[model samples]
Target: MNATSGAPVNAPAELHDRPIGDLIRDARNLSAAEVEKVLSYQREHGVRFGEAAITLGLASPDDVLNALAQQFHYPLANAERRLASPELVTLLQPFSVQAEAIRAVRSQVTMRLGQGEAARQALAVISPASGDGKTYFAANLAVSLAQLGGRTLIIDADLRGPRQHEVFKVSNSAGLSTLLSGRAENQLIQTVEGVSGLFVLPCGPIPPNPLELIERPAFALLIRELSTKFDHVVIDTAAASLGADACVVAARCGAALVLTRKNENKISALQDLVASLAGSSAQLLGAVVNEF
Candidate 1:
């Protein structure tokens, strides 16, 4: 119900705004009579307006959660209906502990990323091996960054074992690999259906020579080109143990975040991975231990 903070006359606020009751009223299109009933029930039952609305079957539990999320200026997509991958906790459970932890990581990454004279164009999420939760972290982190109201894009650069397209529920028939290989696809970049300010460039078909494709200058050129079109570009890369794809991708992006699974990732391997990334020009934006 609130207008944009310094917006001009006749300008409306973004759908994203404050207050649970007002947001619910607007979102559910409640009538005046419905609002009065909800308020009276809320007062009589000593419950919140959203609770009253849900109790009266005027609004669903998902509606109440969405209103609450709007009040706190956070983003939430229905867990039951968002996508096939429930691992994107930032969208599916924005208030959960896992989501909060990922947001904390986002905050740190953003702050560190903006400190330099020349801000980095993109960030590559890399891990030493598969099953290290690299794809999961990249997908969730992209959602969190998009929640900051910036146009954020997550590129599925892991041509070997790409999962971002599946995670975001976008078609991977033609994406980064196809685009880099000079092949034509109907749609290369896709706007994620539910989450605002988020986009995905899937890995397309799995190339037999993923390393060779990534090693080509076209891949770096594509990252640079995409950087100009997006506010924040998050790249999901292949595992370092698989090849040098992650390192090369990170070097091209100018920044990298190292991810490791708890108990499964060896300390020595992680240290060596850090050293390898450090040797490159890419700024090491610190490492994340993926416990989830």
Candidate 2:
């Protein structure tokens, strides 16, 4: 008898289109009897399969979530690798909670500018301070946009503490800094290794004067050229409090996403950062509370 339907289940058909209970059972996370118990509770109370499994204490929240992801055909990330905070969710585990959060952020950003418009070109990801995870959010957001089939470029504009080059695992030998100084031309922008439709413009050599480099007119030209080349360009900026770099970049990008961390971030610091951005030409798309 079928564990979910209580009918004789066909193996091939069940493999393709089984109910959540059967899918969870097939994952071998729960025994057949346990699955039947969960199904019984689900049918009686009209609760979701994952919720029912969690309520009955048959599965941990993550186990039920993995089972649910299996049912929906969304692949999970490889847990062994040392992927950065947001990289796993955006690149490998599109079905996970973290990935969903990134997507929600994407939707909010899109809604602000309306998708497929020139106004949506570049977005600078900024934060009140360093620990707010702005770089992680920017990297993941760019990957999510690429997953939507747009040609997306992530610029490591945080020259003071550049990370996108390391995040994408590419060489930072020649990028935005070199381009601005006329050391390199269009050849520096490199396509990210694994992700399709995703490119990275790493902050080249750490300059002695980071703010002076961004103030150049060539910096504005670089953004203008990238806007024409990519469907979306995401700039990772330095923490707003550290220096004027983020505000300068944001002013040129014309839009920004502010990231805040729970319990770890200070409200007064965030307010000060917001005050600074108020003077920039960039529109504040929205704020994201990153739990990770």
Q: What is the C-alpha lDDT profile of model 1 across 136-250, one tens digit per residue? A: 9999999999888868899999989999988888898898889878896476778886777789989999988898888899888888877877778999999988888999999
Task: Give the alpha carbon lDDT tens digit for every residue of 1-292 in model 2.
Answer: 0012255555466333567666666565678789889889999999998788878987666666556555554334333333543364665666679989999988888778775665556899988888788878898888888777758899999988898887777789888888777788557777765565778889999888889889998898878787877888999998877798988998889898888999988999888878888867889887889898
Would you list the clashing residue pairs of candidate 1? none
Q: How accurate is candidate 2 locally (lDDT)?
A: 0.78
RMSD of each: 4.5, 9.3
Whole-structure CA lDDT of model 1: 0.85
Off by over 4 Å in 1: 1-34, 43-48, 54-61, 70-73, 115-117
